[model samples]
Target: MANASNLVIFDIAANNITGPVPNNFGSLRNLKWLNLGFNPLGVNQQPNDLGFINSLVNCTSLCYLNINGNGLTGDLPSSIVNLSITMTELHMYGNHIYGKIPSEIVKLVNMTVLELAYNFLTGSIPDSIGELPNLGKLDLGSNNISGAIPTSISNITQLVALNLESNMLQGSIPTGLLNISTLEVLSLGDNNLGGVITEEIVGNSSQCVFLYLNQNFFSGPLPSNIGRLKHLVQLNVSNNKLTGDIPATLGDCVMLEELYMQGNLFEGEIPLSLKSLKSLALLDLSNNNVSGSIPGFIKGFHLIKFLNLSHNTLEGEVPKDGLFSNMSAFSVLGNSLLCGGIQALDLPRCQVKISRNKRKTFSLRIILLLVLLPLGSLFVCLAFIFYQYRKSKKMNGSVAVLHDQQFPRLSYQDLLLATNEFSPGNLIGEGKYGSVYKGLLESPTRTVAVKVLNVEVRGASKSFLAECETLRNIRHRNLIKIMTACSSTDFKGNDFKALVFEFLINGSLDNWLHPGPYQENERNLTLLQRLDISIDIAMGVDYLHHHSHTSIIHCVIKPSNILLDEEFVARVSDIGLARFSFFNTSNINQAQSSSTGVRGTVGYVPPGNF
Candidate 1:
C-alpha cells in the first residue's frame, strides 16, 4: 500500500481472489516480492490489456514477481521486457498470455527462473532467451510456440531443466546443449524435431534423470555413451527412426525405471546387461527389429511392472518367472518364433534339454546294463514300441481324413511357401488365436487367407477343431469358404496347424468403420453401403442358424468378424467360437444349453452368457 511505502513483502496466494489485478500496484516502490498466484484475478479483462505489468515497472526493487495460475487473458504486454533488471524470478505461466515473447525480456540479467509454460503463447522462441546469465530453469512446454529451437539456448550454462516439449518446434537438437552439466531433465518430446540424437545430448548430462525424445524423426544409432547418464530414471525414444543395436551400456543406468524404445528401427538382441537394472519397472521395445532369445534374466526383475517385446523378431523360450509370471503385464505378440512364457502368453512349449551331467550318468548306467543279460530284453521292448507308434500314426492319419472328407488337405510346407515363409510384409491381420497372412496357394493358384493356429493358446486347438467341423458341411453365399486345412509339423519339427480360406481383398469391416489417421486412402462407408453390409451379415447369420444341417450359432458376430469383398459384398468369418446344436431344431432363443461358458468377443457376447 502507498500508505506503507516501506512494505517489502506482499503475499496473497492460493486464495479464491477474483477480478482484475490492482492497476496501481507500482505505488509499492519498496516491494521486493509480490505473490498473487492461484487466483481468478484476470476475469473479463479487455483483450491485450496487460496494463498491470506496466504498473509493476515502478516497483524497481521487485526481485520476485509471481502472477501465475490466474485467469489472465490477452497478449503479454510489450512492457514485460522492461520489468525490473533486478528481477530474479518471473512466474507468469498458466495464464492466457498469447503473442511472441519480447526479446527485451533478456534485459533481466539477474533472472534465475523463467516459468512461462502451459500458456497460449505463439511465434518463435526469441534467440535472446539464451542471454540470461543466471537462468537455471526454462519451461516453455505445452504451448503453440513454433520455429526451430534456438541453438543459442546452449549459452545458458546454468540451465538445469529445459523443457521445450509439446510445441511446433522443428529441426535437429542443438549439439551445443551438451555444454550444460547441471541439466537434470531434458524433455523435447512431441515436437517435429528431426535428425540424429547426438551423443552429447545425454553423454555429458550425468545428473539428468528424465530424457524424453519420443515422437520425433530422430534417426541413427543411440549414442554409445548413452549410459553415461547414470542418474536417468526414465528414457523415452519411442516413435522415432532410431536404428542399430541398443547400446549394452544402458545397463549402467542402475537407477533407470522406465525405458521406451518402441516404434524404431533397432535390431539385434536386447542388451544382456539390461538385466542389471534393478530398479527398472517398465521396458517397451515394441515395433522394432530386435532379434535373438529374450534373456531369461528378464524374469529376475522383481520391480518390473510392464514389459513389451511385441512386434519383433525375438525367438526362443520366453522367461516365465517373476514379472514374466503376469501375462497381462508383458506382451510377446507378433514374434512367431518365441515360445513358452507364462501359460497366458499362448506361446509354444519350450523343448526340454537334458543337461550334460545327466547324460553322462545315463551313459554310465547303460554301460553296466550292457554287461548284464538285460540288453536282449531291452532291445526287444524298444522294437515293439517303435512298431506300435508307426501303426498309431497311420490310424491318426485316417481319422483326420474321415473327420473332414470335403476339406482338402495341405502340408505346412505348402502354406509356408505360399506365404513367403510367413513374412511380416505379407501379414494382413492379427487376432486372438493367431496372425493371418495373405498367401497364394498353388495348383488352383488362388489368393488365400492363412490363419495359423497357435497351439500354445489354451483354446486354440479347440477353436481349430470347431472351425474345421463347422466349415466342412456348410456352404452359404455370405459365409467364408474354407479352402483347406493344414495339420502337420513345421520345418522346425513343431506341430503346426492352419486354416486356409478365400482371401477377401477389401479387408475387414473394422477398418471401414474406424479409419486410422495414418490411412490416407481410407474412406468412410456411405449410408447405402452400410445398409447393404448389414443385410448381408443378417442373411449369413440366418443361414447359419436355420438352413445349416446343424443349427449353428455364430457366437462372435462383431464387426471385425465381418469381411468385405472387392465388390463390396459382406461375409461372416472367424467362426472359431461357433456352436453347433446337433438337434434338428430351427427355432432357438438363447445359446444352446451345451454352451457351458461365455463365448465370443467380450463386448459382443450375448447378455447372460457369462
Candidate 2:
C-alpha cells in the first residue's frame, strides 16, 4: 500500500548533528523553512554524502534553507536552487565547503542577504551573483577565491558592502566600484591584486565611509576625487607601490582617522593641506619617498599619539612636540634628510661653517684706501642711517596699530610658564601642530596648545613665518581659537616664539569614533552627537569657504581634528596653514577681503642667535 504525504515542520538548526543532510528531507514536501546550520556535517561526519540533499529537489515549497555555519564538505548539490525559489535570506558562513559556489544559486533572484564568509570556497566570483537586485549586503571575505571582482556587481544598486579580503584574488578592481554613491564599506585588502590605485576608483562618492586596500600591488597616482569622500572615516591603502606625491585632496575627509599609507613610494613634500585634519591620530607614512621638511603646519591637529613618518626622505629637524615628542616610535628610520631627534638613529645637526682661510684673507690695503676714499661716503651713510631710523620708527607705529586690530600680544615666558617649560608633566596630548600642554594660569586652569616651531629644520624658518601670518587673524567657532602669540628672550637673551590656543577637554574624535580595547560605553558620543558633530564641522568648513570675510580652506579634515566639547558640540581646529605652508590650497568663496594683520611671512622667529 502506498503511504500518504507526510507533514513536518523541518526546523532543527544548530543541533550539532554529525551526518550528511538526510535524503529523507524531501519526504517533508510541506516543509516551508529548514535550518541545519552549526552542525559538524563534514568529512568528520559522512565523508562525501552531501548527495543526500539532492533528494530535496522536489521540495518546491521550501522558502528558507539555512544550512550555513556548518563544516559541510564536498561539492554542493547541483539542484540546490531548484529546490527553493522563494528564499529571501541565505547565510552560509563558517563552512569548509569546497568546489565552486553553484552558479545555480544565482537563480534565487529573490535572495536579499547572501553571506558566505569564512569558507574554503574557490573559483571566480560569479557575475551572476549580482542577479539579486534587492541584495543589501554581500560578504564573501576569507576564502581561497581567485579572479577579478566582476563589474556586474555595480548593477546591484542596493549593494552596500563589498568585502573580498583575505583571498588570492588578482586583477585591477572593477571601475564600477567608484561610481556607487551608496557604497559604504569597501575592503579589498590582503590580496594579490595589482595595478594603479585609481584605476577604478569612482572619485565622487558621497557615502564611502571606510576603504581598505592594503597589502596589494597597486601603483600610480591616487585620484584627486579623494576630496569627495566627505563621509569617509578609516582609509588604509598601505603596502603598495603607489608613487608620485600624496594628493592634498585627502584633506576633504573631515571625519577620517586611522590613515595608513606606509610602505609606498610617495615622493615630494608633505602637503600643507594636511594641516586641516584637526582630528587626526595614528598617521603612518613610513617607508615612502616623501621628501622635504615636516613643517609645523600640522600643529592644529591636537590629539595624535601614534605618528610614523620614518623611512621617508623627509628632511630638517623633527619637532619635539605633539606626535613627535609623545610618539617617538612614530618616527622610525631610513630617511637620509631627517636630523636631530632623541629617537634611534639621531637626526643630523645641519649647520654650515665657512672656511677659516676665506675669513682671514681680508686685504688691509683695501680697507685703508676705502677708509680714506669713503669720507664722502661716511656723510652720505650718516644721512641714510638717520632716514633708516625714522623709517623704522614709522613702520613700528604702523605694526602696532595692525597688532591691536588683530593679533593679541603675549610674551614668550607666558607660554613657557603656562606650559611648565613644555614639560611632560603638564602635557595633555600631542597635536598636528606641536606638543599640547595643559596650561594653568593664575586662578583658572586654561588648557591651550603650544605650537613650538621646529626651528632647527632646514627650511623651518619659512614655516614659522608662514604659520604666524596665516593664523594671526582667523577666527571661527568651529576652528581652534588662537588666543595670542608669545615671543621673548631665551636663557641667553635670545628669542623663541609660540602660538597659544584653547585646550580641548576631550582628547580627539578618534577615541570616540574608534575606541581601542574598551567598551562602547567608554565613549560618551551618541548617534545624535556624532551627527551633530558632523554637521558642525561641515558648517564650519562651509563658513571658511563661503561665509568668512576672507575665505580659507582647512586642508586636513580627518576625525582627529573634530574636537568635542563637554557639551558634545564639534569645533573644527586648525585654520589656514596650507596656503602659507606647502602652497597646497583647495576651493574659494571668491570673496576679496583685506589683509588686516601683519603679512604672513614677516612673523618668522629665527631658530637660534643668528
Q: Poorest 10 consecutive residues of model 2 by lDDT?
A: 601-610
- State the lDDT of candidate 1 residue by residue for 165-222, as single tens digits: 9999998888878558878889999999998877766557776888899999999999
lDDT of 2 by residue, 221-335 (tens): 8777787887788899899988888989888776787789998888898888777676787788998888888878654457676778878877787677655565444665787
What are the lDDT figures for the candidates, one per model?
0.84, 0.69
If scored against the real structure, what TM-score would every candidate get?
A: 0.58, 0.56
Cα lDDT for residue 534, candidate 2: 78
Give the candidate number with the greatest lDDT.
Answer: 1
Residue 518's lDDT within candidate 2 is 44
Candidate 1 segments whose C-alpha is farther than 4 A from its true place: 45-49, 351-610
Candidate 2: stretches off by over 4 Å: 1-45, 49-69, 297-305, 327-329, 343-610
